[model samples]
Target: MNPSPDLSIIIPTFRREAMLLDAVHSALAVPGLQVEVWVLDDSPEGSARSVIEGLGDPRVTYLLHQPPTGGHPAVLRNRGAQLARAPLLYFLDDDDRALPEALARACAQLSASAAGVLISAPQPFGDDAQRVEEERAYFEQAVAWLAQGPSALRVVARLLFGPALLVCSTCVIRRDAFLATGGFSTTMPVYEDIDFYMRAVRQAGYVAMAEPVVARRVGGPSLISACTRPQMLAAYAESQGQYRRQRGWWEFMALKLWQRLGR
Candidate 1:
């Protein structure tokens, strides 16, 4: 039997066969890391199974939840967490690519800090070069702030106004700590990363690494891209309310208005 894995990389995918295969390969290619790639396939037609079987990698496991779990990846990701055997859990999207030394570096950092979660910056790559460049700069700034150990309020503000640093695919958390936070919110139709990060950082504490460990494939066919404007607006409003409650309504409103006025 294969030895217990040092890290369990959970990838929730649906019908993205080619990208899923590529992600699995990238996870498996991490040098000096004992990793298991768990592909939670929520594909309606079970299309991802063939890709997993085709690779025939022992380190990879393909799980198909029958009757489909709809489009919410949070649900599928939680399911993968339930079956994970490793102590460290890394969530990677089927379309993203982890850098060659990403896992190794993350392992070293987490080992040293023993923090509940480790957040890494992601470099964007796709047809939109300008957007990618802008995203990279944003991530750099966010990581710099995060590395300084800012207060929870500051972190939330950065998340709301600055670039997103704690992307699901770029984060690694201890399995127990993840379960303690009740995993990702299934009710969040979008911005689940932001929701989870807010709670995780508060619950387990976090360490931010500035290196770009993951490559986000921008301009892809994703749930975020497909979300209607109204849907996004509603999600944003809910998130704002959550933050407002934490910071108090007056302070929250004042900060929000100040941000809007570019002050």
Candidate 2:
């Protein structure tokens, strides 16, 4: 029998049929890697089922989440994490395509380390994608900070106070740690990733692959836009609570002072 998959990619999609298929195809195109792609479709009527069945590819598994996820990717992603069969996990957006060679390199880097996260840059497409390039550059710069003298401190500081450093499609998360840390939040839809990252970055070292690993088709879709008022409030509240617990205010002040005083 074929060896168990070397990696598991979990994609949470809505009613985006063509894009989801493209994402799955891109995932399966990796050379010399046994990979499984799990598509968690939260679309009403389960439209994605037909798409996966038509491909008839055993490597792809389709799950129709009941009552729909209401555009909450965290809920779908958490479910995918539990059912995954690989030690290393990659989260790919339904609208993005994975770069095979870059993904292969990232997998190798993460495998060499015992407990760490892997981050790679994103190759954006379309007009809205330009902003993604700017964020990708910032993330790459922070990734470099991890190689500095006070590695963990620098990374933790940056992550706590800086702009987002995650593009799920281009990163690798260790499966065990993901589960142990409770994965993403189902209750807090918006910024659930930020909450998850705050905890994960503290627990693991990070492996950085400077090259781009995902071709993200950007049209600015997010859980934030679809969130209800209560959900948005909960998101804001939870993030503020987390910030307080982390002494974020104090740290932010210290970082600014260090920048000017050359500390």
Candidate 3:
């Protein structure tokens, strides 16, 4: 009934009610923008309903998938995007917190540039000092490479072999552009963000912002943390095969060589 907001912040959550509340609060706190927060709960028992309703925020919409779709953040994210009413869509993890100026800065950058997607370098927070250090190094490398005006091959190469810059929570994309790109892959249980980012960067192009717009909490038993190393490697291998099929074998080989030579 109400008019659409300037931006839609879609947060896919499962069994983390408290963290989802914090994430919603952070979204609401974003300055200088009219934002609608969509909480897509995939919990089996609709556990997040009470928490979302208790917030009593008009701008927040609570969505629960009946008969529970199991633990698939990528699927929920795509569903959220489909239901989004705003021109801009931001995918935020339920455990992460957006900086006060995150949306405002993203809006400014989108308005100033022709790039379809804008990604921020997130600052790692919480208990894991080791993870924080690793993320910092990764962020530094990613920013440096992004500064060089990377091509589609470079984007894919960095995502696969170098420091990955494809954190879904730090991304802000145009609603139309996102829909056109076919959204995230439903088949990928891991590296789905990377898969989506490679396609998005190639189709619409991207801009990387130096400053962090979100605080990524570490040391938690998240989806990434729960996955075994073998599972991760298998997923990466599968993704690489998909990339070759989609982007052509020759381009993939050329890109791999280009990355190797540059390094």
Candidate 4:
């Protein structure tokens, strides 16, 4: 049997070939880390099979499903988590790049803290490819928000409206803690990450916030905010309702509307 890897990097990709390649390279390049990188392809016929195969890393596991089911990133994530042999799981977006020392820091934190459930770093990315000065300011502001406190409600609020540092790409979660929250919800097309984080934080009393782990490439095809307001609002409502029944109507409502709107 293969010895369990120290970390499992789960990246759900659709058709982002070049970006996915970059993510794979980053995962491999992170030194001193023994990691298994699983690419859950949501593309028809596993469009990335050849690419992942070319990477030639024994630690890489490439999987393909039918079109629509493959398109569901959340389901892919949960499936990856279920298959992970490691005690720690890191969910990465295909377009993001992991910092070289991220895994090292995460391992250290996990080793030190027995109580922390989720350990996350800041995500520094520009809204667009140009990488403007304003984006830097925004990035700094986002990191500051994540550094503030550890309230599940506050984390949910930031995930929905603020800089979105709570994205799975920058997070390293304890496997059991993630499984306890039932992983990601595949019911919604969007806001699944936020929904997962909210549930995980609510259940796991503490979530660790460390330095930024991934230099995320924002404004991708799958970004929730890239969608129009109506689509976004609809997802918000769906996610809110789901959170309500499981968590509470009041907290769900607060996260869905009131608190997000700064009411």
For TM-score, the strongest prediction is 3
lDDT-sorted candidate list, best first: 3, 1, 2, 4
Q: Per-residue lDDT of 1-263 in model 3, one digit per residue for the tens?
A: 13868889999988898888889999999887888999998887889999999988799999987656566788988999999998888999999988868667977897688878887778888787898898878887777777888765577686765557858877788888898889998777688888787778777888878788888888888888888898788877877788789879897887778777875
Q: What's model 1's lDDT at 5?
A: 85
Badly placed stretches (over 4 Å) of model 4 are 119-135, 153-165, 223-226, 250-263
RMSD of 1: 3.0
Off by over 4 Å in 3: none
Better of 1 and 2 by TM-score: 1
Better of 3 and 4 by lDDT: 3
Residue pairs in clash, model 1 = none
Worst 10 residues of 2 by lDDT: 146-155
- Please give the lDDT score at residue 99 for candidate 3: 83
lDDT of 1 by residue, 64-127 (tens): 8776868888898889899888888888999998886977798778868857888888889988
Candidate 2 lDDT over 1-263, as tens digits, reads 12598889999988889988999999999877899999999988898899888998889989999978777888889999999989989899888899998898889888998756776677777576567677556666655654454454455555445555665676788888787667886777677776676566666766667778898766466565466898766775776566566656776566545544533
**TM agreement with the true structure for every prediction:** 0.87, 0.83, 0.94, 0.83
lDDT of model 3, residue 188: 73
Write model 4 residue lDDT over 57-157, tens digit each, in one string: 89898998555483568888998999999887888888888885866677667756764355465455655756544544565665576567646567666
The CA lDDT at 262 in model 3 is 73
Better of 1 and 3 by lDDT: 3
What overall lDDT goes with each candidate model? Answer: 0.80, 0.76, 0.82, 0.72
| Residue 81 displacement (Å), model 1 | 0.7
Give the Å shift of residue 4 in candidate 1: 1.5
